[model samples]
Target: MIPIGMIDALPFGNSRRVRNANKFTELKASIAIRGVIQSVLLRPAADRFEIIAGYGRWLACLELGLTEIPALIKPLSDEEALEHQMEENLNREDLNIIDECKAVQQLSAFYNGDRQAIADRLAWTMKKVNERIEILKCCDEVLEAVTNGTITVGHAMILAPFSTKLQQGTLSKILTEKWTVSYLRERASKGQQNLALAKFDTAACNTCPHNSAAQSGLFGLEDQKAACSQPNCFKEKTASWLEIRKAELTEQYGTVLLIQQIDESDRNTVDSLVVGEEQFSVGCQACEKRVVLIDDRLGRALGSTYENQCIDNLCFSKCVSALTSPTPIIENEELLVAALENELGNTTPTISTETAPLKAKKAKTEVSCVVPKKVIETNKAMLRQTSVDLLMPQECFQLAMTYAALKRLTSNYKSINKELSNPNRFEDTFKAALRLNVSDLKAEIQNITLHLASIESDQTINITNMMIDNITFAADAKAVAVAKWIPTKEILSEYTIGSLSALCIKAGVDKAMDSKKEGGFSTASSAGKGKFVDAILAAEFDWSGFAPDEYIALIK
Candidate 1:
């Protein structure tokens, strides 16, 4: 091995030339800053040195303007040098994929007679070597893409299953359209047969109400949930036709008829008028129950429009009016007489001389109206009876009375001038009267107080157990003190006494020792302090020492 002057261009082989010039530039920058971390391997030839490995470094050194470089000089046969060169280039991180594929292919050819021998020498699977050989069969475009780093070998492998023309088409699509390899694979898996087929027509989508609603942004999957829970549930569309009908009626009619009004007599009539299949129906057996109904058939029809589909009662009523009205007939005789003279040429030609002119048959009546008073009265009675039945139970009523009395007394006290009123005197008198006259209320209050006390005692026990488990005697005394002071409420459920002690041990209590570092006296600070005080009381009563790490962990 010797350090020699750098050669302008080392002749290894024309086939093994650099593909990416930027890679050499990066190497030059790295060499300038940190010098060469590795030395090039070379073999002595008949007249000069031949590079066995480290072509990238050789180029980088050339770019860096280094006149000479350190080299590992090794004597080897042509076959051995070539094998070492392939291994070295294969190991380089920045080796271009095309160059690697080419090198692997040549190595396999050179060592054809020795398959296992080559595999062991290269430290690669026979299967992998075979796959690299197959990669060489890919068309020039695909190979060029692989060389330029536009597509990965994995992507190439997916494309490998397709015909060369198909691969080229897919590659072109990917490059032009920026399709991801996964998306390509997904499309391919769907089969190439469908790729040429026309996509579904947008106009065809108008046939589906859901598609229309989605396009218009009027309804979505979220609104669908609300529709399901509504009184009218329709399958083909999300919104109930009943809701649309109500909105329509509200907009068009001066007033919408009460559900009771429709249910009592004309719900069937309205359903027959609204042009759709009935989805939901409700009827009240007593006092004319108001019922909400949906027509799913109409919903499907209007939903297809992708816009407002309101068709209210008012519109239906108008249609009914048009159908029932009679055409006008003229009753004036002057016009009739003129038309008769004009047609008959002033003829009063034939006068009927029968005994007495028969009177024209009387016209039949064409309109009728009806009203029901008994039904209205019955409905009012039912409503009043239901209201009375909903009163509170006897015990709840008694409790309410006691609460009212207490509230009244409190209100009267509040109204008094504080400067003139003796609150202590008022409280004492009130307490005495409450105890004497409200014995049951007093007992209830005592029970509540006892229950709260029990809960507090249990919480205190839990906090004491945590401090004992977390604190260690070897920790800093101040940190121990701080850990003890941390409130039980502040500790997360996962932080047992042992864990808190470990945390205090990690965090020294130097801050706790400084008076200036104490948190301020705001409501939040007070609550925190209260928690710390509770923890401290628990620790002190249990004779637990603080672990600095445990305390610090808690703080963090």
Candidate 2:
């Protein structure tokens, strides 16, 4: 037995950060009734002893005010100490998976990332080592949640492959919505696109661990069926392949039509072009209307395409009408010519080359000076205010509106208001020695009062005009302010998928996403927009001049 005071815990001794309160209480009770039954493992350390195992038992003994603990003191290296600590923690019924991950990570580092060696040392299967190490990819919040028993290790594993911010957001949803492990498992499995239908090369996916075929060894699968675990990667490669195919089609056929870009009513397939008695047109191959199409099947077939379709149904209908219509002929050419000239004279006059440029320039000048009826009405209303004696009331209103708009538009308004709360004050020590006569002073005061009312009237006019116009210079200025606006998942959730995709594409977020990972581009483009937003927030990227048109339209 060694004195409890003389024994110290090694750094890796406490594997669990959060312990079950009931379990700890029961342990203390067990020790109090039976005293120390099992001897703790320890090693000699500079006149004292360092605990190799049984740190929890040592803690229970100390809390009970016990002076001595039964222990077997032996000299062990750091590796042996860590192994013993892990063994003791693993034996406990209430060990947190996060603590297990931390212990495994330490052991991994000890062997310099030799997975096989670490697995052998811990007497665990290679698959188990791979699974535990993958759990480390989860964000801090997820790991903490697992440690706190808010979520199971299965949930953590499902969320581990995604980005950190996504993991955090998904964890919150899992708890609040009480998402079942089965639902997550189903979602994880069903979200994958079939490898057999993929337009891209399947060579790389054959060896990828994210591929179902590559996981047969780890998962102990009887069959080596192929499927993709990383939907983003699959989507990205498929999109790239589709683009390459589009480029080739564009070279062969002058025009390539995207089926999604055409309206349902305007699109026609080659098979549909064959009328009851009419045969399929062979000339279509060489005609100008010979267009190749790529169809996405309304997002059902995300990275797949359908070839050889026409978007111009109206043109085909016109050709058919021309072929079926009867022709009319005119016998008197001079009479027809005279009739045409008279009609042209009454409706559309021909302008000489020299006069055309002058007419166009005059028309442009007239158009530029013609103010919108809305702006004119606002100006006229402000002009009717006779009480205010100020020049250019409209310009003054514009200046005041601009300043007010800038403050509200920019997020710095609150900080600027804080600065205004405390202003430097100075006393006017020197007063004017000469005072104006009573009549002059009264005239001056009246003039000042009139100017103040003019400013007030300008403000009132601006407020009314803003509602009528619904658009102003302020909206464009707001775009500049919005450039500095950082987007959160909540903020992004307010936008539709189409709107978010538009904003991300315009901002070159797809390219940025691709730069980070191999299949990131297509995955972010087609999958949830939240991943793009999360990546932007994580990198603290300077998305300068990035403003959603809808956001600007709100003010307009």
Candidate 3:
């Protein structure tokens, strides 16, 4: 037995936060009448003992003016004592959900954010631990509702992801209108912002009440774990940032193309801008169709400016289609001026009579296609605010695939397929898109642009192939050297046996083929060139390492 004064009570224990006043009162009465029926568990703490369990029994004995009480005293580490307290509290039937969550939170903090340790010590599932920790993000008022039995733990979980103001507002509706858990969930889903795709800087979001990370006090969220509670603020910031970026680029270059979101049905808009694979050139930056595809979602998510690619799919086909047979295909005023300035150092070159007809033809084409400024501004405004609703489940799946493909095409980042497949990733990817309103069962998709040149060209397979080619055949000589461009039977069919043999020799495959049989090259040659071609194709070697000679160019 230990003296009652030697034992210290928990500062925030179940006994202090009464869930059932009558039950606690009866316990105290029972203790007074029958003495302490159960011994309280305690841990030695220097000069005194700390209650590890049975807080109510200890409190009742202390109130009854008992000088000594039965106790099982043991020496335990801080972590062990916390585990004991949480285990005892969690098993109680009358423990308030709020207090239960707080106990779990304290245990979590005691282990320094090692949730698995808490789970293991308490023999709780990781999912249960995670849910309890998430509930701890709920504001004091929302938690109070859970304690008061006005809302369930499920309602608090849904409300935990939103701001305190939003939580309070939604709580009033839930109380006045008697909303179900599913309805509250639906409302919360509509207002979330996926921080992964945000265009603007999010350093301030760390402390903002509207961010889930701030609400939970979580830091360094690299994935879609963090979300914005205020969708309107996120939308306005993205829109404003994109506009400012566009303006800055426009000032640097005469005209810059902006690529945002476009509907899959309106494929012609991006199709008109990007027609073919236009090679990059120093003078191409001066062209009106130079693209600046703004992928605010990925740019902000990955913390990379390279996510905003400068697509150089110049309007090559568009320009060629505008020219007549008499006009030289290379007769663009910008190109001509650029070339003259490069060769003659600021000398203004006069237009020869021979070029007059070409200039006149170009002028006619420009005048014929002139759109009014008001019409252009209206179109721009409409494009800026575009939203798409994907109704079918198949459509949603297809969009997810497209999003994965875009990530591959536009950046060096890889392995996003599994990430996008997760349900939470899918929700944030679709729900928090710019101008996208995913309400209830419906999803509004936006913020996708395939081409910066023309909205009509987004659906063009040619542009997609061009992008693939551009990455596959990179600008760096070393990258092209190691590119995995192995020749298939179809590609080999284009090359003659002589060319194939030459490439095989360069790759050291000929030596292996010749050594396989006596007089192998002679025998294969005598049988016909097909034998040699077969030998080259069947050779077990790294074909990607081989590059054909310049003399064996494709028969274009």
- Evaluated with lDDT, which candidate comes out highest? 2
Please write out the lDDT profile of model 2 over residues 1-556, one tens digit for every residue: 9999999987444544557788878889999999989999999999999988887788999999999999998898765776677777776766766666666665543443457887898788999877887787677798888877888989988886555555777788899999988888777555655577676789888878788876666656676678787877875786687778766555344345444333334345543243211212223332334355564321334334444444434345544443445244444454445446656774433433244322111111100011123323433333222112221243433333333333232321221222222222110000110122334333433433334423221112343333323223233534433543445666554443333444565567756767778667566545554565565556434567664433333333
- Tell me the tens digit of each residue's lDDT in model 3 across 192-302: 777866768988887787777654534754444678878668867876887777555433332332222211111122222332212222112222233233333323332
- Kindly indicate the candidate among 1 and 2 with the higher lDDT: 2
Q: Which sections of candidate 1 miss by over 4 Å?
A: 1-23, 33-37, 113-117, 147-149, 161-164, 178-556
lDDT of 1 by residue, 1-556 (tens): 3344533233335236455677667778898998778888877766677777776787677667776677888898655776777777777777677676677655543432234665777788988765665565455688889888898876776665344667788889888887887897777665422111112223433343433233443444342211111111122122344355555433222122312111111223433233221110110101011123222221122222211111222233443454345344435455445545656876452333243232333332221111112322332333223222332233433442343334333322321222223323332332333323344555543443334423121111232222232222123524434434433443322232222222322333222322233432122212433343344333323224433222233321
Worst 10 residues of 2 by lDDT: 425-434
- Arranged by lDDT, best first: 2, 3, 1
* Candidate numbers sorted by TM-score from highest down: 3, 2, 1
Once model 1 is optimally superposed onto the true structure by TM-score, how far is the C-alpha of residue 221 displaced, in angstroms? 44
Candidate 2: give its CA RMSD in angstroms: 30.9
Query: Which model, 1 or 2, shows the larger TM-score?
Result: 2
Judging by TM-score, tell me the better candidate of 1 and 3.
3
Which residue segments of model 2 deviate by more than 4 Å? Answer: 11-13, 185-556
Candidates 2 and 3, the one with greater lDDT = 2
Off by over 4 Å in 3: 10-19, 45-48, 192-556
Q: Is candidate 2 or candidate 3 better by TM-score?
A: 3
